[model samples]
Target chain A: AQTVTQSQPEMSVQEAETVTLSCTYDTSESDYYLFWYKQPPSRQMILVIRQEAYKQQNATENRFSVNFQKAAKSFSLKISDSQLGDAAMYFCAYRSAPSGTYKYIFGTGTRLKVLA
Target chain B: DAGVTQSPTHLIKTRGQQVTLRCSPKSGHDTVSWYQQALGQGPQFIFQYYEEEERQRGNFPDRFSGHQFPNYSSELNVNALLLGDSALYLCASSLNSYEQYFGPGTRLTVT
Candidate 1:
């Protein structure tokens, strides 16, 4: 069985500063994908960034980036130039890369508070 | 193109009652997946439908059932609901096995 862990229950960041949310997972599969999702008060789960296990280069989406360490089984999200709008619940997710395995295993989540 | 859409936006049902939630996949997407997200928790996978048939399911009980139409639209039906079933039901659609696009989610409140 595979599981994702987000140890930080909550995190705070000052406006325009950077913040990193840590996540780790237990998985036996070598091929998989990691993701970071953001859910605001509106209840919409938005994809922030994704990293493929096969890719050594980390994934970056504008202000958001990921530090994916496949061997360590750790994937973390870093938000640069954090703004008030960045405050939300962030979730780390894992999905098997094998065909037909479509379900996503998610971490409990970390509440991000961006202070002005 | 419109993203995944679910309705009604909110539903309130009593315990032991049955409830149905609907989802319309995004344009060009043929796979639909459902998830349950409890308050302050991450979303849990429910099931996935493709080719109008269920291809995958999670750890949910048989009381939780679903259907996918020929048009790729889907419905989630829960029977004998419990208070623990109260949560945000999310619908996601993808083309093949690509990244999924999520809906705003329907908030189901079981009293």
Candidate 2:
């Protein structure tokens, strides 16, 4: 069974600054996908970024990036120049590689607050 | 392109009652997946429908069942619901890959 873990329950970042959210997982399968999803008060789950297990390079999308360490099973999200809009609950999720199977194992979300 | 959409944004049900939630996948998507997000917790996968057939499921029990229509729209049905079933139910759509596009979830509260 694959399990995602986020150690931080709450995190705050100064506006215009940067913040990194920690995420780790346990999985026996070597091939899989990692993802970062953000949910605001509206409760809309938005896909932030993704990292394929086979890709060693990290995935970056605008201000959001990931530190994907496949060997260590660590996938952390970094928000550069955090804005007030970035304030939301960020969740780390894992997807299996098998076809016709899209089970996503998610971590306990880290609530991000953009502070002044 | 319009993204995934869910109906009955918020609903409250009593114990032992049954509830039905609906989802429409994004344009061009052929698969629909359902997940449960508890307060301050991650969304747990319930099941997925592809080709109008159940393709995959998670650790959830029989109480959580679903159906996919010919148009790829889907429904999540919960029977004899309990208070523990209160959560945000999300509908996600994808292709052969699992990099899903999500919908604004339906908030289900079992009283």
TM-scores, all models, native as reference: 0.98, 0.97
- Tens-place lDDT digits, model 2, residues B6-69: 9999999999999999999999999899999888789888998999988888889999999999
RMSD in angstroms, all models? 0.7, 1.0
Flag regions of model 2 displaced more than 4 Å. Answer: none
CAPRI level of candidate 1? high
Q: Can you write out model 1's per-residue Cα lDDT over A1-116, one digit (the tens) per residue?
A: 99999999999999999999999999999999999999999998899999999999999999999999988999999999999999999999999999989899999999999999
| Interface C-alpha root-mean-square deviation of candidate 2 | 1.3
Cα lDDT of all candidates, in order?
A: 0.95, 0.92
Give Cα distance to truth, residue A21, candidate 2, Å: 0.5
For residue B31, give model 1's deviation from the true position in Å.
0.4
Interface RMSD of each: 0.8, 1.3
TM-score of chain A of 2: 0.97
